[model samples]
Target chain A: MNIFARIGYAVMTVLAQLGRLALFTGKALAAIVSPPIYFRLILTQMMRIGYFSLPVVGLTAFFMGGVLALQIYLGGNRFGAEAIVPQVVVLGITRELGPVIAGLMIAGRVAAAIAAEIGTMKVTEQIDALTTLATNPIKYLVAPRIVAAVISMPILTLIGDSIGVLGGYIVSVYSLDFNGSAYLKNTADFLHSDDVTSGLIKAAVFGFIVALMGCYNGFHSKGGAQGVGNATTYAVVSSSILILAADYVLTALLFHK
Target chain B: MSTPKIQLIGVKKRFGSKVVLDGVDLTIEPSSSLVIIGGSGTGKSVTIKSILGIIRPDEGTILVDGEDITHINGAARDRVMRKFGMLFQGAALFDSLPVWENVAFGLIQGRGMNRAKARDIAIQKLAKVGLTEDVAFLSPSELSGGMQKRVGLARAIAADPEIIFFDEPTTGLDPIMADIINDLIVSTVKDVGATALSITHDMTSARKISDKIAMLYGGKIIWQGPTAAIDSSGNPYVDQFIHGKAEGPIKMAVKA
Candidate 1:
């Protein structure tokens, strides 16, 4: 085939796949609205996917905020604006750095784990077993993960933002030779509630995307060990890319205000 | 004398252009064992998967308890599944869960029984399968191949399912271990009074366990009769399969 034919075929193939995915998504949504919610399963998954993820997110945010503060001090000093460290740090962490960093980290950890767990289940016919047992696999498996990710991500982002801000605060007050009160005032002045809100909203959306990609990849996974490994790799890579893309779009829309 | 526990009528399934099953029909009587013998790629697994609704048939019906479950969904599917237990080709135990949890998976996860109660039943099932209580605390990966199959069997009967499916259950184990598992399956099925449907290439297993034996070739059953009559079924395909001879009506589908 010529270039035009090749391009057209690729586009058609992608369209076909997307249509199938949409249909599957509709089935999932239907399963969601149906009775027998499995609240206990949701709570169990929340503990595993969300609550347990705190330490890594906190540690990453703390160091990221600290390092960001130091970088801004050096960069701003070149322009005789070292005093802007706190304002820059707070805006950067609250609006961009905190959610994006925490999101990327979680996309790697949670996505891979969910894919592997579900993939193993798929290969062994446990998922099929559930279906035979008359349990809606969507409600029992997919819904819990999706709900947990959506609810837990915002909380994780909130905690991460606090730790990130504190990390910047420590650096600004100690190493940057700035008055603590002035630093606090600039941070408060530069950042509004919208910036923080947008970041948290992005975190929740990213969480859904992360969990969705993981479950989608793993649930459809084929072969055996290699198929599961591929699902894990695809989950992490795809979710990370999607997070970055989403961050840009959300930022452009939010910052336009 | 009772109605067949499972009846697959004119079942047809195709994957794209490749037809996996072409108008297949089968029946398994209650408390009786049926073994489907076929080659590796001749759709033995597809036949089982179709009955379970894991792979939907393009045409025909799968009936359990005289009810068609082929196109069924939702709570009805689960209700049907509760009556069925399966021992997969591999043990297929959840590695993250302890041995007892894996055994009690159906009881705890599907039925929502208390873990303590589920754990006690799991130990009993494990003991029935010849594993001790201490072995229940270990992970599935910690167990050997034979041990895992035993664990898988334990899980299958955990809920006292009315029917059981075993897929190549004896293929990977040593001869003695395979026979041991086969015997366990025979005794357990009898003990629980469960109908059994199995597929395997092992004629020894087929002859030992099944009262009725069917040979699947070219996506259809070529011959099916009592196990005692298999040797004299006089069908070339059945003769080739049970005798393990390659130079008859059965031809290997090698790429070369």
Candidate 2:
């Protein structure tokens, strides 16, 4: 094919994929609000997406906060601003790092799992089985994951934020020889409510993106085992990219001032 | 006479450039076993999916009980689906649920039956398929292929559906097991008085279970007759397929 033809084909392919994703998102959201809600399934997914995810998110956030404090201390030492560690760490953790880190972790864990599971079901004709059994695949499979992720991310982010701040406090007081009481006072005084709420809002949007990408890729998977593997990989890649992109957009809108 | 139980008129489906079903028309009578015989990739599964509203035909009208169900959605679609029970090629039981739950899935999820009641009916259906009560609590993955097929058969008959579709019911079973399944299919279908539509390349299973046979070739039903008359179909493709011949009017797509 000529260069122009190749370019046109690429554009069309991207547009087609975008269109499919949009349609899938619309259907999943509709299923979420419609009747015949499966509370049991939703609760089951919460345990998987939220509760099971706590340890990983907590560990990452703690280490991230400790590293951020150390880096700030090193940078601030040159400018005679070492005391700025607590304030900067709290600001960064509550506003950005906590939610984004937790989001990425869950995307890696939950999104890949959902994609592989559903994609296998598709290849094995279990999804078709569900249809023949009078169960809507979107309502039975996709909606629960999406709803669970949406409800879970914000809560996970809140816990991650607290753990991260505590990590910074530990590093600041014990390692950096700072006064523990004064560091706590500084972190509390420096952090604002908007910082925490904005991060949570970002978490919710990231959660939606993760579940949507997972379901979309899995539902459209074809062939067999190889196809399911590809779906799982794509779910993680697309959701991670989307999470980062959404973070920037949400950050601009939420903290523009 | 009674709207033929199920009807497909000019059903056509295409995936990309390849046409799977091209203007195929069929009528399945009530309380009769009709088996569609064809080679792999012959649109046999697509035909059943089209009738079940899983894959909508690009152009066609599908009627169930004389009512057009080609484009029904939501609750109406669910109601239409409640009339069908399908046994997939690989049994397709949900690995997440145990054997009994797989059988009772439709009753509890589709019809809102209490779990205890659904479980009772599930066990009864399993018993009808020659499965004992001990197999009910086991996961589908724990069962052998023949046992899984039995569980699939039990699930199909669990709801006492008006129409049952078997997609290659005996594809991977041994001859003895396959014959046993064929007998169970014929007897249980008769017991429930349900219209049975099965698709298979297995000539023995087809000949054993079906009262009538339809041969599909080149995306169309080329010949259909009573099972006894299949030998005298006089169509080269039907003869080639039924007799398992390599050299015939219907050429296999083999790469040299």
Candidate 3:
């Protein structure tokens, strides 16, 4: 084939692959309409993908909140307006830093794990075995992860948001020598409902993206050990990249003010 | 004569310019084992996958018990699949689940049986594969390779499926364990009276478990006959693959 033809063929091949993936996603959604909801399986996935993700998300959020408080204090001090530190720290964590950090951490933890688990299953033919047993794999496997991620991420983000604000609160009360009531009041006054709502919304989207990327890379992984390893790496890297890009887009839309 | 349990006519599958299956036809009888033997990349796995609807053929009609089931979708396709049990080559047991939960996966998840009931059946199936009740609670990662294969066998038979597919079941195991697995395959298939389709390069597994042996080459089943007659099949491809000869009609892509 000519070079032009080869390029065209490559593009077409990519499109065709996308079409196949779209078809798989549709089949998974269709299976969701069937009976045998597998509620127990969903709950089990929720525990694994969501509930278990707390400690990592909490630690990351706490540290981030403290760091944000310190940075804002330093930057505001340069302007002789260090009092803005509390407002800036609370607003930054609730609006951007909190959900994005929590989402990225969960993505690193959950997405890579899900991808590796499911990818290994794919290569070994466990997914095929499920099909042979009359179990729709999308419902039995992918759907639960997706649902759990969407549901659990918001809750996890809220907790992270609270802990992160508290981290900022601790930093401000002790190091910045701000009165506790004033710090709390400044935080309360400066942070809007939209800021928190936007973060939670971003968390849900990030969770969806993370789970989808992980499951997608995993479900389609070929070869043996090398294929699964590649899938796990792809899941983490892709999820982190997508999380950051999405944060920018969402911030622009949700907080144009 | 019994009706064919599974039949594929003029099946074809191609990946881009490369063809994986070229006009393949196969018929599997009920309550018997048919093992497809081929060197790697000859499409034995692809054939089984096509039968299971894991990979759709470009042109073919796959009939299960005289039903043209090539294009059915959603709930109907799943209903057709309920009759099958598969013991994958690698034993594909879920690492996240305990051994019993893996075996009873279909029983509870697919059939909506309560956990208590599924656990009972799970333990029973595990026992039949030479495992005790204590082994049921361990993760699949904790088991030895041989034990893993047996657990795979247990899971395959757990639902009492009418059909079973084994894809390279003996790959990556010691010869002794391979023989053990071969024995287990024969006895279990006989016990359940389930129709079996297996793909293997291992001549020992092919010889031990197959009542009928089919050789796949160039994307077609070039020779098929009784297992006892594979020695004198008279086909160069079959002879070469069976004996593991380096120089034969079936050439490998050897690099310098």
| Top of the candidates by lDDT | 2
* CAPRI class of candidate 2: high
* Predicted candidate 2 versus true structure: per-residue lDDT over B85-182, tens digit per residue: 99999999999999999999999999899999999999999999999999999999999999999999999989999999999999999999999999
Compose the digit string of candidate 3's lDDT tens values, residues A1-257: 89999999999999997797678767666655666676777788889988899999898888888888888888888989889888888888888888898888988899999999899889877888788777878878888788788888888999998999899889888887889999999989888898889989999999888888888889988898999999999889988998999999999988787
Alpha carbon lDDT at A86, candidate 1: 84
Stronger candidate by DockQ (1 vs 2): 2
Proportion of native contacts kept per candidate: 0.55, 0.83, 0.90
Better of 1 and 2 by TM-score: 2
Best by TM-score: 2
Instruction: Give the whole-model CA lDDT for all candidates, comma-separated.
Output: 0.87, 0.94, 0.88
| CA lDDT, candidate 1, residue B147 | 98
* DockQ of every predicted complex: 0.51, 0.90, 0.76
For all predicted structures, in order, the TM-scores are 0.93, 0.98, 0.91
Which sections of candidate 1 miss by over 4 Å? A1-5, A30-35, A38-44, A74-81, A252-257
> Which residue pairs in candidate 1 have backbone atoms (N, alpha carbon, C) closer than 3 angstroms, thus clashing?
A133-B78, A134-B78
Better of 2 and 3 by TM-score: 2
List, residue by residue over A1-257, the lDDT tens digit for candidate 2. Answer: 89999999999999999999989999999999998899899999999999999999999999999999999999999999999999999889989999999999988998999999999999999999999999999999999999999999999999999999989888888899999999999998988899899999999999999989999999999899999999999999999999999999999998787
